[model samples]
Target: MRLQMHAVKFTADQSLLDFIQAKLDKLDTFHDRIISGEVFLRLEGADSNKVKEKIVEVRLMLPGKELFVKEHDKSFESATDRVMDVLKDKLVRFKQKRNDISSPAIAEAKTRVDEEDEVYEADEL
Candidate 1:
């Protein structure tokens, strides 16, 4: 999947970029269908504050839907981690719903198999 990183208002170092890239890459294991993603890193709150909160925003593009997550923490890494956790849950649920087989479909398949088995047994006897 293609990932675009945007460092809003500040320049991000190579290590931070690599770290976020690695984390986003792992998401493909959960949902390989992910087409692309965008990550926005920004510092929130006023500069007067001794410590500013790091905000991480992620948008994942799928086949027909888009998933977004935002998290803030004292560190960018932690915020990114939290965002990934939320995205993971969403991806898992999305996969589950997509792969779910309806009851009627299951029942129809079972009936066909049962009929075939019965016919085979009768022919044997």
Candidate 2:
């Protein structure tokens, strides 16, 4: 998966960037079809603001849909972790729902075919 990390208003250090990349890399294991991901880290204090105002936004791009989670914390790492956990759960559930929707008809057809095959075998005997 392609990951694009944008740190708004300030330059992010190499270690932090690497950490974000590693965290997001695990998301691909949940669903290999994920196209890309965008991480936006914005410091919300350009104007007069409080000290604990760091915002981290993660956007995940899939084949036909996009998932986004935004979180605020005292530190960017904490926010990133929280968002990643939420995204992981969401992705797992989405995959499960998609599989469930696609499997029922195939299962029913297979059962009918098996029954027909059993009848044909009995007739031949």
- TM-scores of all models? 0.79, 0.77
Question: Where does candidate 1 stray beyond 4 Å?
Answer: 46-51, 103-125
Question: Which prediction has the highest lDDT against the true structure?
Answer: 1
- Clash pairs (backbone) in predicted model 2: none
Clashing residue pairs, candidate 1? none
What is candidate 2's lDDT per residue for 1-125, written digit by digit as tens?
79999989789999999998999999989888899999999887756655557899999998788999999888889988999899999899888877784688878988898988764566687
lDDT of 1 by residue, 4-120 (tens): 999987899999999999999999999999999999998886466655799999999999999999999999999999998999999999998777776577779988999887645
- Residue 46 C-alpha lDDT in model 2: 50
Question: Every model's Cα RMSD, please?
Answer: 4.6, 3.7
Candidate 1 accuracy as TM-score: 0.79
